[model samples]
Target: MNPVLHAAKLGVLRGWIEFKQMLKNPQEFGFNIIMTIVFLVVLYFQRNKTIEGNDMALAMFALPSLLGMLVVFGGFMGAATTLTFEREDGTLLRAKATPNGMVSYLISRIISVTTFSMVSVIMLLMPGLFLIKGLADTSWSGWLLLLLIFIIGILATLPWGAVVGSLVKSTASSFNLTMLPLGALTAISGIFYPITSLPDWLQVIGQIFPVYWLGLGMRAALLPETAVLAEIGESWRYFEMFGVLGIWTIAGFLIVPKILRRMARKESGSTMEKRKQEMMSRGY
Candidate 1:
């Protein structure tokens, strides 16, 4: 086998092992459960409410949008947090010491992050089917479209997450960097409500980010055609959704490698030790 392929295979195994470990960890497992519960609770409260212009249940409208938000949060925040924590703890330095280690490390991180995100999506979608109405009305084609949008959403966001992780100085800073902006974006991106209800300027700003397009794509998959009436231009605009997400995907792919390479190059034993000492001094 090619050396790189062999390394990637090992990385896959590593990612699987790490994912299992995460499942075993009480805090991590509890976090997943808590998140799923929170989503269900929020949707449950809105189950009886209907959108103003349409008879569709608001919970149904928000369900798919919430899924989009989960994808963005899982992919972006997961990648960013893992990178920052590992970097601080000298995992990057250990990878730097091995042959083809950076490649393996990157592969493993991607696998872990993708799998973790998908698990969260499934957790929300399964129970949500019973708790929320109108979600099961999709055809096979609609389901396929949802799957495609999901893959694209992950690709669009994960690399940028890596970029954010690489730029931040510490784990705390990385969390703040990714989450704060994402929270604000989610508010305006129509995850919880219709974008058409927001101010036009806010709608334009929301459209500029992947979160809005992700939510729109999800809504296009799950909602009835009439739901488009609540969207800008009274159309799903699949073309624009793909166009914006594709731009992010292309830009992230082009940029993440350079940033990762720079970050990896900066990893050394001395630096790791220094960071470790600082972490200890700070009582972290």
Candidate 2:
């Protein structure tokens, strides 16, 4: 068998195994539980409220948008932090020692992040079905569309995540690099509110990133047609959503491998040990 193909299979198997193990890990399991509770709590409070122009409960509006954000977050933050930590621990170094190692590593990250995000999505969606009223009516097509968004959203964000991970010096820096920017984008991206409510320039800036498009795609997937009235141009603008996401996806693919190659070249036992020593010095 070909080396890359064999590596692909190995990566897939490893990714699945890691995902299964994640549920058994206390910290990972607790994150899922805490995330579900936090989202549900917020949705519970919003159940009584409605989008300003629409009869849809704010919680109903938010749930899917938050799901979209999770897809992006899982791909971006998930890959970045994982890469940064693994690099510090010498996992990347080990991978770099093998044939087609980066390919396998990238594939595994994609699979792991995709599965983890799906679990998080379901964790929120299951209770959301009971907690939020409007969602009970979601059709099979809506579920399909949601899945499509997840796939696209992952492709759009994960490479960039890997890029960020490769550039950052440490896991702590990865969080600082990813989180603060993500928070700012979330504020303007309108995951909890419609972008139509944002200022004109902010709206343009918001639409430039994958977050807004992912949220828009989710809303299109799950919300009633009438909800478009609250969106810009009063339409779903599926063209723009895919177009923007496609650009990001293409851009990520073009740039990530080069970045990863450089990062991997710089990875060695010494680099890993240096990172460990720095962490020790900081009492981490």
Candidate 3:
């Protein structure tokens, strides 16, 4: 079998095992499901509103952005939390001692987290299509567009999870810390609102990150063409989104491995012992 395929398959199998583990401990996934429902419900109520001549504008913007947000959030936070928890518990150290262990472990994490995100999207889509009449106009092409952006956006975000996972020392801290950036990303990403209405500086800041582009792609996927900015001279904005997301994906590929390797190199038995001791001292 091809090496990459072999590795990926192994990763996927490991992911399945991880999914079973997650199912056994349902709090996180449960919370995520509830949050998805809450968000969709909010949008459902707002379905009667109009924006820029489009009814159910908030749903159009929120649903796809929520898809990207949920996936990115799941990939980054899930990996970070799992990696940090394992490190604290010495699981990562044990894995590190195995041949090709680190690669397999990280790839497994990516697969598992990606799987979770896809599942979340699938669960959200049923009501998103049928119950949320706002999305009634969304077509097969929109779904395809969403899938493409999601795959790319998830790829762009997953490696950052690696870096975070390798660097963090505790699952507790990982859970809390990961939310800070993610919450900010969701807020500024134009998930619930239009980026155009944001202050100039914030819009610039939003442009600096992938969240905006992902949100824009999501908007493009779900919103009517007239609802988007498509002036003849400024038509490039839509094309620019793919370019921006692609650049981030490439940069993440190059940067994340180096950071993970460095983090791995910094790991030592003594460091693990110290972490264990610290956790014990904290009574966790």
Candidate 4:
């Protein structure tokens, strides 16, 4: 087998093992459960409420949007946290010492993060179907569109996550960097409400980010055509959604490699030991 292919295969296996181990870990499993429960509770409160000027239940309206947020949150935070923690623990240094190790590491992180995100989506979606209405009314085409948007959404967000992770110095810093901005974006992006309801300026800001576009694309895929009445311009704006997300996807692909390579180049035993000592000094 070609060396790169062999390394990729090993990475896939490693990722699968890590994912399984994560599922088995009580802390990680509980965290996923808690997140799902929180989502369900929010939907429960919105179950009887209907969107303004539309008969659609608020829960139903928010379902796909929540899925979009999950993609961004999962991919972004997952990558950021994993990379920061591993870098601190000298995982990157070890990989640097091995041939093609960076390639393998990158592939494994992608698989692990994507799998974790997808599982979170499924956990939320399954129960949400029973709790909410209208989601099950989609056609096969709608399902296919949802799948495509999901894949694109991951591609659009994951690389930026890597970029943020590479730039941050610690896990806490990574959380602060990703969560604060993401929380602000989620509010403006209308994950729980219609973006059309926000101020024009806020809507413009939201439109520039992947979270909003991802949610809009998911809404386009899952909601009925009449539901567009609640959207800005009363249209799905598929072209705009794809265009913005495509730009992000292109930029991320073009930029993440250089950043990762630079970060990798700086990883050495001395640096790792320094980081380790800092962690110990902080009692981490």
Per-candidate TM vs. native?
0.97, 0.97, 0.89, 0.98
Off by over 4 Å in 4: none
**Residue 248, candidate 4: C-alpha displacement in angstroms:** 0.8
Better of 2 and 4 by lDDT: 4
Q: What is candidate 1's lDDT per residue for 1-284, written digit by digit as tens?
A: 99899999999999988888887888987898998999899999999998889888889889999999989998899999999999988888889888999889998998888888889889999999888766777889889988998899999999999999998878999999999999999999999889889999999999999999999998899888988888889999999999999999999999999999999988888888887788789898
Q: How does each model score on lDDT?
A: 0.91, 0.90, 0.75, 0.91
RMSD of each: 1.0, 1.1, 2.6, 0.9
lDDT by residue for model 4 (1-284), tens: 99989889889988889898889988977898998999999999999999988888888889999999999998888988999999988888888788889888999998999888889989998998788877888888988988888889989999999999999889999999999999999999989999888999999999999999899888888888888898999989889989999999999999999999999989988888888888899999
Pairs with backbone N, CA or C atoms under 3 Å apart (clashes), candidate 2: none
lDDT for position 232 in model 4: 90
> Can you write out model 2's per-residue Cα lDDT over 1-284, one digit (the tens) per residue?
99999999999988998899998999987987998899899989999998897887888789888998888888899999999999998888989899988778888888898899889888988988888776778789988898898899999999999999999998989999998999899999989988888999999999999999999998888888888888899998989999999999999999999999999989888878888898999999
lDDT of 1 at 188: 98
Per residue, candidate 3 scores C-alpha lDDT tens digits across 88-195 of 777778767776777677778877887788888777776787755546687889878888988888888777776777777687778777889889977876777766
Over 4 Å off in model 3, which ranges?
Answer: 1-8, 52-56, 134-137, 229-236
Question: Candidate 2, residue 40: CA error in Å?
Answer: 0.6
TM-score of 3: 0.89
